[model samples]
Target: MRSNASDCDVLIVGAGIAGISMAAHLQDKCANLSFMMVERRAQPGGTWDLFRYPGVRSDSDMQTLGFAFEPWDDDQSIAPGGSILEYLRGVIHKRGIADHIRTSTTVISADWQGDQACWLVSVEGPDGPEKVRARWLYMSTGYYDYDHPYDAQITGLESFAGTLVHPQFWPENLDYADKRVVVIGSGATAVTLVPAMAEQAGHVTMLQRTPTWMSVGPSRDRLARVLRRILPRKLAYWLVRQRNIRLFDFLYHAARRNPHMAAEKLSEGVRKELGDLYSPEDFTPPYNPWEQRLCLVPDSDLFKSIRQGKASIVTAKIDTVQTDGIALEGGEVLPADIIVTATGLKLSLGGHIKVSIEGRPVNWGEEFFYRGCMISNVPNLTFVFGYLNASFTLRADNTAAYSCRVLNHLRTSGTQIAIARPPADGLVEGEPFPFSSGYLMRDLAQVPKSTDALPWRLNHDYLADCRDFRRNGVDDGHLQFELAPRVTDQSPVADQPEMA
Candidate 1:
């Protein structure tokens, strides 16, 4: 530890579900280690806290999304944002993880101090800027950029006469009641907002250039409820979680294997819900199912809204944003008092933090992922990487467990640093996630290169990843562990050096 710096065994950034899960795992597995979680926002619930748009809910099931350590026992598998936030808060208090969280603190940068074998993390808090040292840096910061969402460049956007809101930064109390609302974009946010705002607004219209695949399912999991009634709590959770994983995997794989068949089934579902109201042109997507994220509408809320004539869908290209309304390419004007931009989010890796190895900045695109946990050649830093197709927490739990294993291995081996050394021709130019969403496509090159094989590849298969991490122990010979350089001078200058 450096003489001038306060030291912690682990420094976790982002107090979201991932960060909280990691903290819980660390406490359970590495009892002797000291750790702290820093949240950029004033509150702790990450996504749940930030996104306050009406009808905000989880796209994934709670059985799979919830941490295995602290299982969600709710009957509703598809939970509302407030419910999920409450669940996270409950987990924090129950696990005594609240004390470790430092809110309203932004981690600006993390620089590796080679001499002292620690990360000098620069963070901006309410008081001011300060620096702290950590032996290992665990990043749970999500992929999206918090400060800036994806800027959807719409022509004549400044000509809007009414309130323009982005779902990312929803206004506190803007009266949309009796106002004709037009939500642009057919993504998850738009799907959620349409039905929610339709109940109150005069009329709600979903304006999209392209249609997205939507799936409808029951709000509560019947199987999970039955199992919970018959089996033990932990056993019920485990069983339901595994079943959901297999079901999700099967559906995703089936959709890819037989896209036409899968598309028909999805279309049938819409027809069942909307009946005569379902328009083939408006409801059907151009691409195959699971090509992009499939929007989930619990209990056909969106369809119900449409059937009741509260909401409507307009599948057309926007010609321009007029002061009174949006003009379509075919000269159709849609009157809207409020325009909601439910476009997408911008990708930012490592929470937009400037990460450097002893003053040398890391090029993530050039590096390979070490079992989807750590970056290759980057020492003493692990990440909580989640899955794209499946529930994020499934992989987050696995990554947390793997990180703990690495921590234990280091402690047992008396090593100060652990770096993953990639093999020759390791950097293969592949997609980080196979999804072709516009937001993901825009910044694909900014993230790490995908490898072709295990230990380096960030595979989307949760089951395969789980098996590999379990079977392949820490001593795989790929990781190089070394004792840090001894600082004999004990001077602050010798410990922390500026980038050359």
Candidate 2:
């Protein structure tokens, strides 16, 4: 029932920013090698294409979020969703990478064939199931799942007469205009949706099960424009990127090192904005800022929406859903024509695919991380994880650069397989992984903790990774490879890693 798929030197899953960037980088280094990128969606731009809620914009500035090869040419630093998607599409076209992408092709499973020492990838396409063999498999499926909403099973959800929509699964034809909307959850999605839906809806009530640290800053930076005019385009871009990087770095580090100081600085800003309307006790999180990402309300737009009486924030746990409203745990009833569940995303590290070597599954939770790139015993696979502070692209760029170096090294050494094995001690002592909740927590026990990984201490520090990954090779004595002498008129030998 399966068709044979075309073989390639490398097969990349996902056509999002990470996948595209990886392809672009690979093309630059190895021109002769063939690669194919498969995206489940009809188009590129993974999250950008999926999220269509109003007021959707990058939490990070475009300068940092954008690809390294292409500079985002726009007046606004904080770009809207449409612009970001356009930029990605343009990057795909300009790089001539569009031809290699297979849209609507979903990778079902990747199984390592020990006999062939290659990956036998099963993909589902329009035609049917197809199998493709590749020497290397690059997964850019992202750390989060694709628009799979985490809807809490409310008692009366099925009986509710009104339209119930999760932001991730927004119905295209659903009209919110003049309708009373209740937005559940208080994370970034809810914060962004409340103001956006408020614009069209008659009223929006943001219901939260818990408190989140919300910080408001200007959506559009006037200084960005002034600098753009004064300085060259590239220089301006670099300046803005660096400025934001340093600012975030300082704030994140200050919060980690001196929680009291960070809290004081954050409190001053909140007090000025809300005056007596907000209480510090209720709003402030028990954890330090950046313990989780501080939700950014661009240009105080969320606040403006609230000030205009279009939106209201209610901090309480929901008891259940009613026929036409929501009942709070404290016996309060709030009526709504639509319920928008803006709850958090379901985290799936490496797309939650079970990775196995031979017949044994690799326990990512129990493994030690090597240079934040390779997991111990995981050979020939390198994952690109972005920084928590700066733009994710920065860390991805470093990962690409490191990959180039590693590949080049292998080529020069006449090595067929390379792997990073953890030391025999089995215990990796370091800082806790930066992320605190969702699926990440569930699999934390098996995955490498941040403390064990260098330059991956939760905070985004690009310069450190730049120097480590680019300037120096894998430093922890972890990178291991198998070598086979080059043969005349013969393909490179495939060496499979030994599974535990």
Candidate 3:
């Protein structure tokens, strides 16, 4: 298609936070080894770049959302999409990781060649299909797919006359100002959108099938700003990062351990903030605060919007979509000039990419999740999965660090392929990993279910898992030190070669 497909020491898929962090860690630790990162998008910053909806901000604070090596310098704790994208771009440029990334290159399929002890990767690019062989394949493709949208089939959605938009594919030019906007869904996207659009929209209605626990905090951290002004930039960054980490950890742990008390406190807090304007019955979720993610309402902005009569909450199931508005199942029709589906996304493991070993298909559904990083039978592959309790980046950083350790171990032991095996006593099968219904139920038909071994377990207790993963090889057990002949070294390639 273009030129001869070149080989690499490691092949990384996805140029998102996970892939970028992995590449950075590998480059910093193993400078002698050459690796290439393949990203399907034209640029980096996967989710941040893709979702450009109004009021789209990180659910986690910016300090924690950012890479460990890079600290977010923005004044706001909950940074917007544009700021996060810029920060990621800055990190890539600062680290010079752009050189190692092959943009607009998609890995179609990967097959492990047992005899050669290498992975044969077939990729599609702008020019044509190309193939490469790598001793190690690291699937840093984030859990969710870029183009997939979770749109529930509404009965009369097609018949609606007004513009209907999904937060996933928000139109850049659509004007919400002076329009009676109705946002559907009760997740983070809807929470964020309702408040933001309410500021300008003629009237904004938050239409929710179910309520989600929403908590309010100051968008700008005053202490963080003060420290930034007084202390050195690096020191300020470290202090704020540590403080937020501890705070979030405590909150999440409390909620998980004492659900009843936590739920009461969260509900009381919301009631006090919104007073009579926010109906506790309609706004408060039945589940515990952290059972599902607690929606962050910066500075009680959403409540303020409600107080000002700019926004209203409507909890009802949509029976049908009328040409002028949405009809509730209870026979009430609400008028709206525009409808925004702030619905969640489809959960796809490894971007729905195909994986096979020695010509046999690897059924991910049947596979075990080993330490939430590697698949049971998947050899020489490590994925980037973050903590469910704390900020995802914190866990991602730990994953990157542990991956480095694993790589070093492999190099020292002359192990070309290492696969993690479940416990012999079958403890892995007995204790399936716990996950939220959103992920488990949303894509049940598509993704594999977590069995006892190699199950999808999210470690909310951040430090414990971080220490365990970093020090311990694998939680249950790992098939370590599978030796193979080394690949023949080719000519040293230039760092910044143009992508074919």
Please, what is the TM-score per model? Answer: 0.95, 0.91, 0.92
Candidate 2: residue 374 lDDT (0-100) = 58
lDDT of 1 at 366: 79
Which candidate, 2 or 3, has the higher lDDT? 3
Which model scores highest in lDDT? 1
Q: Give the poorly placed runs of model 1, Cα more than 4 Å off.
A: 1-5, 487-500
Model 1 Cα displacement at 250 (Å)? 1.0
Per-residue lDDT tens digits for candidate 3, residues 1-500, read 43338788788887878888888888787765678889898988888878888888988887788877776778999888888889888888988989988889888889888766778889998878988888778888877657777768778988889989998888988888899999988888998898889878999999888898878788888888899899987888889888888888888877788988887887887888878775766777766677677888888888888889999899999999999999999999989999997777777877767889988988876766666666777888877766655677776677776667767776665456678765576433333324364754676555433453223443456766666665656423455556543333442222212111
Error of 2 at 242 (Å): 1.9
Tens digits of per-residue lDDT for model 1 on 350-466? 888999988999888778888988889999898876787888888788888888888888887766778999776555555577778888899988888776778788898998998
Give per-model CA RMSD: 3.7, 3.7, 4.3
- Order of all candidates by TM-score, from best down to worst? 1, 3, 2
Off by over 4 Å in 2: 1-4, 352-354, 429-432, 442-460, 474-476, 484-500
Candidate 1 vs 3: which has more lDDT: 1
Residue pairs whose backbone atoms clash in candidate 1? none
Q: Report the Cα lDDT for candidate 1.
A: 0.87
Steric clash count of candidate 2: 11
lDDT of each: 0.87, 0.73, 0.77
Cα displacement (angstroms), candidate 1, residue 267, comes to 1.2
